[model samples]
Target chain A: MAYVKINKDRCKGCGLCIQNCKLALLVIVEDELNVLGYHPVGFVDGEGECKGCKFCAETCPDCAIEVYK
Target chain B: MTTEAKDKPKKVYGRPESLKDVGFHFCPGCNHGNVHKMVAEAIDEFGVREKTIGVAGVGCGVFLYNYIDIDVLEAPHGRACAEATGVSRVHPDHVVFTYQGDGDLAAIGIAETIHAANRGEHITVLFVNNTVYGMTGGQMAPTTLLGQKTTTSPYGREFMGEGYPIKMAEMLATLEGTAFVARVACNTPKNIMAAKRAIKKAFKMQIDKMGFTFVEILSACPTNWGMDAVTANKRVEEEMIPYFPLGILKERTTADYL
Candidate 1:
């Protein structure tokens, strides 16, 4: 199984990961903001398990995503 | 720490060791941040952090010294390649590279860039061509595509008046001094991985004393381009790539050229 972790404080909320994810499993949390006052990204509720592709981590300019498999 | 947390798999991606643990001032979705990470990763992979000197040109990339944890020199507008030349000659043992944008390199600094490549200065150049002057607003840059609109070119870029987009990689690849020349984009995961490989190869050329090396990255300036981040990235892939085709334009073998 693959697990993805987002560093909320480090995320700049660019949404590149959400847009680039091949699985379409990530989304931006619009209800809350990070320390930088931007919407943070997270996996969608009840989404399938992460494929461990690391595309989200690779696309994140802020280095906010970490993937473990 | 909880037992479950301790049993997690190994972390696969994180901030590179050569980067400073600080926030970037670049706008959200700016590819400069991504390029910075790639360069930092190259430095860390080569273990040359202590012996690397980065030259920052005027433009949005001027803050490169802030994000990258290396000895960086602030050069005048369009003079990063010239400044890098001086640094490389003075300290040939150290790895020298310059970070520049289209306005700073393709337009005002074209002379310096061409001359440095011709001279084989043994330095690496990271060129970000976002089709406009990002820092000083969306001015029409030399790399701006034909018919592209900018703050200066309000209507659209006219080839008769503004000339066509300057393909820096193709132009530099023609020089005998350059050991490596590639153009890559950062809008997609596949392209980003290719860009990282090109960046690493450019640095390796410098370390091997193979002479000048250049990598032009087609980045997106959403703030200036008047598009959302996702749409801007899409433009890079759908529109820009067709005009600026990506790949290694030149890669001279050490034995044949050097």
Candidate 2:
């Protein structure tokens, strides 16, 4: 039972988490709060497969991603 | 009761008796005893005693195998990093850590130390930097202050000949592979507690499958320094602290832990 949470406030718009997620959980959404002019973070929309490995969280520079199982 | 006299009762607070008790070989009032106790306690706290493997160095702590209850390995003079790498890599599930001194680490084994951090080996390192070599009388180490006299330098060390003290934490913290790097002193009760936390966190980082973790523990060798315990402790505050301030030099949150 792996649950994932991302602290959006810590996101520096570096997009490293999205690049490292390995899972198709995160998506880039562009809107008013996408201050970096990019989709900062979007969670797994329908929860297909997460693996719960937490590679993205471990590699995040700004501590933007969190995962607990 | 004499106002100026008090006897400390012998206490059995470290490891359990089932592991076959063996006493340490440290000098009287040596800080190694307290460090051993704290390391033992850290193992117990993490419940890894049964699965913990301790690597001993070639300094005064060479006989550390006798004191700790867990499985122990004796590394060659300044080869603890090499030895620990094997143990930790082979047994990834177990908690592996190495205990080394200033002479062993900052002197001869510097290559292995840097490579180990660069490789980001998943192991804990308990670094004891006492400035002077403890096992072979008082000789200058890579960390010996500029003017501190030792057997090797009867006169205060000359900067032209000896070079400056190496701030290892700062050097290692700059590496991109190291996950956790902190320096802590083990002189007072408060500092001891902080040291324990630093050590435990290093272990926990490994358990969490994080990368390399190093805790440079500032210790004292009163016998080798030709000073009493009180004076040795005082020197750690006055001389050592200035060079190696106590704090988390570089630490990452769970999100940043790798």
Q: What TM-scores do the predictions have?
A: 0.95, 0.72
* Candidate 1 per-residue lDDT over residues B1-258, each given as its tens digit: 998987778877788999898888888888888999999999999999999999999999999888899999999989999999999999999999999999999989999999999998999999999999999988999999999999899889998898889888999999888899999999999999999999999999889998899999999998999987889999999889999999999997782353
**What residue runs in model 1 are displaced by over 4 Å at the alpha carbon?**
A45-48, B1-7, B255-258
Docking class of 1: medium
The per-candidate TM-score of the B chain, in the order shown, comes to 0.96, 0.90
lDDT agreement with native, every candidate: 0.91, 0.75
Quote the RMSD, in angstroms, for model 1. 2.1
Per-candidate interface DockQ score:
0.75, 0.01
Candidate 2 lDDT over residue span B137-185, tens digit each: 8899999988988999889777899999998888888986678899988
Best by DockQ: 1
Tell me the native contact fraction for each prediction.
Answer: 0.74, 0.00
Clashing pairs in 1: none
